[model samples]
Target: MRVRPELRHLFAAAFGLLVGSAASACGTDAVGIDACREIESARCEATQACGATEAEAMHCIDLYRDQCLHGLQSGQEPGADATARCVEAVHAVAACARAGAATMADCPAEPLVAAADPAAITPCVVIARKPEQLADCAFVAKPADTGTTTPSGNDAGDAAME
Candidate 1:
């Protein structure tokens, strides 16, 4: 049976919308650029409470927006939920501890490439008192395996073969 051309187009459009909506529902979209600044500001305040000079705090916060924008563009930053969690973690810090430059244990780490390349560092790193304290952001362990390697199927099969 031939599908009407218009109906085919309509079906494609509907499928696209469904896929997009599903992704949105699953929170796959990264946090917006504004989140970068918000996290930076909160971190700066915490640091300032600890003893950071106003100038130092301001400079640190200033770097976050542009750097975060860069990270987001680079696709190396955390998603919206991760960023939000980081923000909350920062906010939860005791004023004195934050002032003392305590590690933010809950915040996501800067991506490895960003860590090695200053230009790619995420906004989160901008607020880090010690960037190293933050772990590397989770990334795929390695590029997709492109080599051809048939699975042995099961441990029993491998044992029998051996």
Candidate 2:
């Protein structure tokens, strides 16, 4: 999902803080900080390009943390190899999005469309089912039978879904 433009700054700040913490814990210097920032920037680019939310962007960064910051502590060259890995990671997410779009398109829209009040489905659930269709999903309301029950913020069930 496209993050609100205003929230982009929050994402950047959060990433910066994450990098700073990681760097400080490792006793990294200015160069290391720069490298970390570069990695975070690449992550942000991938997230935006992939239409991912801030959480998704953070998840992606966490997934590839090892490769993104490998050998930084030793002052060894953060080689092109690591950069290539970052690119690959971004492509992987893009591929998944494409696949999700295809799957969603092929899915029987009957279930979704046949609902008495299709306006009642949460955007997050729809997005989970089809990440690429997040924009389209946003306008879809939940079914009448589903009720307009917003889960408590603390509910983690949805997050654990495949």
Model 2: colliding residue pairs: 118-141, 119-141, 119-142, 120-141, 120-142, 121-141, 121-142
Query: Model 1 segments beyond 4 Å from truth?
Result: 1-32, 72-79, 94-127, 130-162
Taking the tens digit of each residue's C-alpha lDDT, what string does model 2 give over 75-160?
43445555445334434444443455333233333123332233443323332332212222112122234543222111111242
lDDT of 2 at 93: 40
C-alpha RMSD in Å of predicted model 1 compared with the true structure: 17.3
In candidate 1, position 91 carries an lDDT of: 53
lDDT of each: 0.44, 0.39
Estimate the lDDT of model 1.
Answer: 0.44
Best candidate, TM-score: 1
1-162 in candidate 1: lDDT tens per residue?
Answer: 999999999999999999999988865454345655665566665454444667866776676655445333324355667666656555544232433423333223322222243333323333343222222312201222652222111110001110
For model 2, give the RMSD to the true fold: 19.8
TM-score of structure candidate 2: 0.27
